[model samples]
Target: MPIRARGARHRTGPLRSPGFLRSLVFAAVAALAAVLPAPVGAQAAARPTESRPIYSYESAVREAVWVDTGLDADGDGRGDRVAVDIVRPREPAQQGRKVPVIMDASPYYSCCGRGNESQLKTYDAKGDVVQMPLFYDNYFVPRGYAFVGVDLAGTNRSDGCVDVGGRSDVLSAKAVIDWLNGRARAYTSRTGTERATAGWTNGRTGMIGKSWDGTIANGVAATGVEGLKTIVPISSISSWYDYYFAKGAPLYDGGPAELADAVESPDAQAHCAAARQKLVDGSPRSGDWTQLWNDRDYVLRADHVKASVFVVHGMQDLNVRTKNFGQWWDALAANGVERKIWLSQTGHVDPFDYRRDAWVPVLHQWFDHYLLGYDNGIERRPMADIERHPDQWSTDRVWPPSGTSAATVHPVNGPVPGVGALSASPAPAGTASTFTDNPALDESSWAANIDKSTPDKAGFATAPLTKDLRVSGSSRVSVTVTPTTSSAHLSAVLVDVGPDTIRNYAGEGEGILTGTDRTCWGVSTAGDSSCYLTTSADKADVGFTVFSRGWADLGNYASDRKGVPLTPGKAYTITLDLAATDHVVPAGHRLALIVAGTDNGLIDPPPSRPTLTLDLARSGARVPFVGGAGAFARATSGARPNVAAGVPDGTPSSPGIPVPRMAAQRLPGGAGR
Candidate 1:
């Protein structure tokens, strides 16, 4: 249901898919009937005018357009042009009032009338269409803002070759924006010329979407197009290599089996296979490829973007790593751009789902503040609002806000509820917990696998809160461990466990109601046998500046044979840093910290073996608290303010990286990559 651009052909008759075409056909018919002048008197006068539906809010209004155009790629006379469709919203303020336009761009053939009709009829029990917002005509049109859904230049109905991450996509977006501005001025409405003029003249256009759409937003923003306002990239990775192929390792060899199945559709599989081959065929170390990837990369130099921004991401998102969000956040901070971020316990697919009513208001507030110029209680809210549990919304002035306290809770020696502390000393060497990594024997090893009961993990907790404790910002943990081999994967989760219910305010229906309960957070990897814990320096205080190898190696650690042994009788710290979040731990709720060598149930298990050792006395965790006098606690000892290690601290680079050259791919109609 992702949006695509409008193309020429009309299939005629009833649509086989649940799409705007069927509705558009009806409207067109009605228009034809009304203007025929054959039926006189009452019948003719009673016919309703073919008008776009309007959704009115306190500050804005919107009208949807269902358009179809021909893809005349070579200016040829033959009927070779493919059919395309698009759904655009006419925003009153954007015309001349100078409102910002928000768009969702993807190559998924979103508007290509395919199986849409059948899909539309299948609604959830709540009567809302399932995944309907992804449909062009359904969501974007009624939002009271200008929304453009394009078919990537050479996919589906769009002409040209499918360049993947090439220049055509970005250029097409720019062209669409220009077209919208002109169309807005030309299309006069009953509201008068002033409204039409204001819609385009006074408007600032921005982009917002997830996955593919998210990537496009970044690309368009990078173009430095005038009036390009801001972007809200959800669950998107800036670097293709870093995100999909390598996160310090090769492609997740055994990760996300579901993705494999999802891509198995003949068409999708073909596209993905080609794309993967392109990745391999194109040299990884090539400056050309690197430059091309970097130019298309959203995170490489986020500072290049001058737009005010807001980012929202989930901690447990297996599809896209949470660290990518950190990269963007840090980039904005480094550029000294005003921004806001929201972190949640949901996954990549949840944010756009309507089951989360909270998002509706939040999005409205954001657009109101930026596009409509209506303060309307938006600025009064926290710069960042995160969800620790479903019922609690924690607010903060900035991300990873200051004022936090750290306390170590031992694993084996830590007292269990109703049980006193068992030991005050560290365990002997090799005296640690272990789990086997037999992917063949494990069904739960798939990516994002969740085990709510008897989780294969250990936890430490603080006593029930004496007062309402709001914990906002990133959370980090340091742990000591020994792997069975040269390399191992480790994952951690921070949960607010108690009698209070923790709702996932993002997912849909049964998925939302019964999805994983833990508000899973950030993750880091270690590549070698070293005492060091891994975390992205990009999230550190000064923002994202590339560090030389002399500073920090931006890769995971690898261990030696016999694995890195945990020093017996010595306590080592394992830091679990959570992404910046907003949540209030109500009085009487305990802040639970769960540490595991793997999050196999919720995500793909690491390709390496892992063993863990916990230090009882010297190891501790940290949590940030804000609000009220004496309501917060300060770090007691052994707690050092987390700094992004290995990066040149506080030094900003100039001009950033240059755009790389890309090799063109050929298309069906002799189009080049």
Candidate 2:
């Protein structure tokens, strides 16, 4: 990664040895030490290193302040003040040694909680933060960096109504960045009239978190705020609309207002009731694109983003969904933003939970390069680190491997009516297959019986692969359907039919089994422990894996923003985009596509149960295959399943990936030693 001199105060000169850099730092500190503010025993300005800690974490300063956001979502007369908890090495303030900030702004800090342990913030007698959640405070503060945890407005110590992803939600976090730069006002206390300022350090900042916490990082970065150098958003949502809806199709019966109500602090309920009401009224069930969604959307404003982005997301994250990252990443690339990504196979999990040993060191280098302005060559490394299988990671210079292209594969009728084969050759024109709506059937049920005829769905499978075939990106299913009713719902599921032992994300633990053994991440304190319960991969033996899926309300066939009711027996062509993915089908596995109505639990059923006829010639999936159509054709042209050719049925069915060895080095956990 080429380093860009982002801030005016930071300079990116020619690369030299670490020893030379330290010497330069010492000389500068000596020349200015007389004029600089130095406490009784403040040491020479400390330099950050990837392997060593030079600052005293136990002696770090800890405090809390309220930054004023110029908004009144709760209809309160005064501007809302957002809570910011700070933990930093004392040397920054005492010795005039400035450091960059690593901040995680979240609404969950006080409500649902954060991390695998679900830890929440704790305060001491003076109302100063005694314990900040997660290992950021423990790890980074000892490395001469400040870790700031911010409570989003309407949650925790912040004052305002939870606006969901609306103005209050986005602006409150942005206000903290502004306060660090002396552009926004803050208070010593939530209701105090006295002012507070961040005078202890340089303003370069990086935001990171998972889920809603990470979502705020994206929102704030999109504001193009100065002093925000980078952001690492893990399992985050780039568009709130995408989170709850898919191309105008609502995944749940509820809307944004219900989410606002769930996370709203108890004290804020009364004041925020009207704000919640507005969310309900503004978001119509009709799935129309409203100002509310537009305001919450960061993709549209991707051009406004100035911060470099480090995106981390699970390929199978159904809650926040993969499209949020997919669309946002594309837009960022289009605008030439500096970016890096880590795509994992787990569903809605933090990398720290699964890949802790690797995650920590990489994260440290990323922050060191971007926030602390160290030329660590992290940016120059591969742009993507993707986990293609269980615990199997590969680095790529570009995602989708360089040669990936969309290849259309059509469904061909077999001797039986409903069951079909997928081929590169187009099916006969006007040929159609029919299936009745089965509101009870989900993707799993549809995929499990792909080769057999069923009333619930029309299934198509390719011949067993002769070689591994990889699908590297999002796919689209286009079909012309004639339905018995004016309104209908359609779904497409892509499955790898074979035997394999994979992460059991569908299980209660959601892919990880927490064990009694505790692994320490950083130093520990009484209020907060850096040691957490160790987790192992929860693997399951499975015959079929649903790798990608898509859903659509046929009424929004032409435009996601507008709905056009269909006339009975009239054919309408609709295309639905499957969630983004990267998966490999082993040689013996058959790649299958199942088309059905009502994904059941995923999306609510349409009012009418419509038996539909699909035009086979016009309907097919456009897949992003690694070697394009040629590779897909060669893989699927073999006469028999590769298993018959001595390929083992349990080729990739290993129990689980072995646990990585953890490092023993520790940093401070929280405040008190």
Candidate 3:
């Protein structure tokens, strides 16, 4: 094996892109203010003379209004607009306190709502906002802050087509920011009649949200908008393409436009039918990168990000995927952007749902430190706050930690070509691994019986570890192979082959289950509830779960965007990247690499299935295992139906990738340390 190693430490966060760039020259120029303040950084640390709370929770002015987006997305000949529902302190203006703002711009307001319960927004008879989902308004309003809920254009009262991450979606909320700082214009009606402005704001603002809402924040901040002091995007999509595609593989046979339709309004779907058709037309089904996707990709424009980023993401989030964060995080770091990250084991969940007690106050301090410009000393803290175990978190100076190194494991051909050992030592020359593509087998079924031979897939394993191994970052697999067909889709998955242990994720819960009881960390109001369902994730041993997986279409070996089909009898070298991860493999555990021609469980099977012949002599995998060995040395010391049958994490089925069945399901009792 021609093994190579790299041990560089780096930071991680979160993603952003597209056609909007063509209209960039005509884009709006002004940034906005929020929290109706005197001026940014005015009264550094002075206390108010007023006896009442500057931000009175009981007396907040709850109002609903519209902001002119200045675009006719539906060809209605009228400017598209967005609805801004606000709840702010009634006493701030009198206290001479121009408060900074915290805003949540979401598309879920009228659809799925927010939080674990999916609470939607409610309004009064006069069309004024009566209810705003989540505890943001209820908690922050009393603390001298304004909580603004904005309905993205085409959803709720906002007017326009749902172009996904296109102009309509981005500019609607941006117009609200403009209205605050006096940069752009807004109106009181969807008819473009009455004008409106933010006479009650301080101009400086910070955006906070989870999932799609968080994605919007990331997209807007990437526009280099001024007054956007910071953004807290949790488990959000940085690239819609990344959201729907993996290494050129489409998710559920749908592309970006289909996703746009998923979130689009039913009434507007027909109105935007032409636009939707254009979306489908522009998005290439061949998996080639297009300007359309580029226009919507925030990561491509990350260099323009001026706002400090406080990112929160579940590392196990298969929905949005950590790739969205890790890739964008790298770009932001390369551009020297200031950032902080919270990497949780939970999948697609808010920190409030994961870590309730510490999340709110920590968030408060973060917003105060940036939006309020208060000397909260939050910047003095570590760069990363990572969850080491369920309900157990610790801070670190940097992510991927410091004392980490990379290692490469090669395929060791033996009894048969496709059957082998993964090691640091070189395999004999002319060795090969062959498997015809099969869509039926999953990661578990293919790898579970390594002792038995199968023609559908290939399996390789390393000797038991002699010391504890910690892998932190993305892993890669490159192979020299010959295919029997022009096109081939290969799935490479990294699996942890080990004894029964406490799995971090049992069905996306991160070993934490939502219970019936409720816990109120903060005060709640009628409209905004602070009480959330509690979590119950025990430190119990469970089954084997996929560590990370990556896929590649053989036709795209030359470029991720373009495809060059292989000649039936010729050899080609293809490389696939496993998901970025930070996992600890115990000394007695084994590491396995499973490769197959197709993962029908995750994607649609191509019309033609191809048989692949891998030259094991040239095939190898590189693991960014932090502090591992120079060789795959031998160990000195050394599941059930659905795999997580009695594991008890409360998650229904495994999310993203399913756990390997019979890997290690049944577990006896052991108290959590």
Candidate 4:
């Protein structure tokens, strides 16, 4: 259930550290260059010419391949290379012509002799071609722009090691940009004017993609690279530790194993299998939490990024959590950089569906505004544009802005507001909920089926909304939990349950489900229930938690049979922080808080059924709200009038918890109109 792209095949054997590929590229480039001939007057006649090769397009869609040459700074042998794919009007703009460039730096072998044809043939679940096809070029390319897919070093035919997250990746990206600009200059010289410019040569470049590619786009932007006008980093993490490891705990258990099992190639499978074994063997070199933090530069400090950004996350993404999006958003806001975010209800792969309709166009518009300098109304857009339950899009100037208040929803036995506080006492002694970790259940059972028959799951609901409420930011629940054993995992989910039916808004179709909108809005449409919305499963979200390891360590507290006896009558508080989102709770709808001993389908079921105790007094739930009294009054009445409006526009009210300045607000009388 975690958002994961289908794995690519490994060519030969287990992937040694990328250090070996670096050596290979260096050797191959040198050997090839040595045998090639030097052209006469090659140095004196250093002029740019349009090196046209094959080109094709149907209707407005266009696809072309051209070769660019430059000095190889790394001395790996091959000339600095640039292969660009252009799709747009053949004629230059009547005025100042500048086309935006959406650069996709592919780790798959996109260059070399394999070409685009070979890449598209690969298939994932659903039998549809898994890889992005060149025929798929029309989506963004034809919209008066160009899409450049760069084959990262050593992958296609490019030289150097395919460093995952090292210096090479950054330098190689810069090198590509330089080559592209040079190509534009050459074309201009040949045409006797700066008429035909390709890629980001004459304009700006915006990075966009999902999974590994998406992560790389962010990595490059973090370098503070110039010309990176803006970026749409979808379903990616800025920090590896927060992503691959959980609170310094290795993520090698259920989720990781399921991902490993999906790889079809013997080589790729062997590598993951080996890594898994090493983890099981407790090998020192297996790269644990400390090792990963030391080995990879995952943290994306606010001061490091120079480009404006639009981050997308999914609420139900079992792989990467909305928390990662919050981390990046907070860092940028703290740095005072222009930023926007979109939280979708779908999972990692669901966003890629052309049928979904909203996100793809938004991505194109983002690039159009930044790369092509088009006044496509992107700048006027809000900092966060999210779609809440049912279906709708809402915009806001800032994210979880100041003035939001935290309102606690506690379970009580008495009447409405005056019901008086439920006894500030723990559950009766010896009372607990127990469930077993059935091995027969598929790993994805938690997120796949939504019949409400799952035994290990528990649900709590809030009274119908008294007023229009926007629950944004992270949602937390404090429960007194004691695992039957010293070492056990606890999982929780915050769901928006309907009055009559249970809806699975976070589920998605086959393939990688990128949780972009769900991460920001936290709610999903009725039919789109394939994605799972929770932050406990993803490392990115946990990294954003306000509390440190001390707050998250439940410690095998539930290791006994009486189901981790709750301190007899004492109340212990366990926090279940749901994924972040901006959603509006209509006056009629109720919000459900779901807590489960296991992450059902997303992660491996618990080793055994553990008993957990609910201490409602010390344990309570807090949601982000925008309007109320005192401090939040201004935000609600002055800016967020929607809180008083009856209609829902997808944007959820802030939980009102003061989490710095990233809270939501509305203009008087609804400025959006």
36-153: candidate 1 lDDT, tens digit per residue: 4555466645353323223222122323221112222223332111112222333443432233466655555332221111121122353222232333334223333444445554
* Backbone clashes (count) for model 4: 77
Maximum-lDDT candidate: 2
> For residues 321-432, what per-residue lDDT tens digits would candidate 2 score against the true structure?
7888888888898999999989887767888887776787788889988876665688888998887667878888987688899999998786556778788988999798
Candidate ranking (lDDT, best to worst): 2, 3, 4, 1
User: What is the TM-score of each predicted model, taking all chains together?
Assistant: 0.55, 0.88, 0.84, 0.57
Per-residue C-alpha lDDT of model 3 across residues 1-673, encoded as one tens digit per residue? 0011110001010000133332222211111122234455764433221111123465677877788778888887777778898888776666565666889988777766677777788987877677788777766665667788988887777777777776677777777787778887776666667777677787888998887788888899888887788899888778877765666766446555665565566656767778787788877777777777787799988998998898887766655667778777878888988888888776667888777667776787777778766565677778888776676676777766776566778877644445566667667788787899887777656656443458987887655566666677778898888989888888887766654434355353545677987765434556555566787653444334466777777787888777766788898888886777766655655667788877655554665788898888888888876554432343313301112232111121222335322222111000010
Tens digits of per-residue lDDT, candidate 4, 52-92, equal 11111122223333233343423445444433334443432
Error of 4 at 182 (Å): 7.1
- The regions of model 3 sitting more than 4 angstroms off are 1-54, 414-418, 450-452, 500-512, 538-541, 628-673
Q: Show model 1 residue runs off by greater than 4 Å.
A: 1-100, 111-145, 160-203, 238-276, 281-297, 314-318, 341-345, 349-352, 355-365, 372-381, 387-412, 415-458, 463-469, 504-555, 558-580, 603-673
Q: Where is model 4 more than 4 Å wrong at Cα?
A: 1-100, 108-144, 153-175, 178-200, 241-288, 291-299, 349-364, 389-391, 401-403, 411-459, 500-553, 556-576, 605-609, 614-617, 628-673
lDDT of each: 0.40, 0.78, 0.68, 0.42
Q: After superposition, how far is residue 65 of candidate 2 from its true place, in Å?
A: 1.0
Worst 10 residues of 2 by lDDT: 664-673
TM-score, model 1 to reference: 0.55
Alpha-carbon RMSD of each model: 17.2, 8.0, 11.7, 16.9
What lDDT, from 0 to 1, does candidate 1 have? 0.40
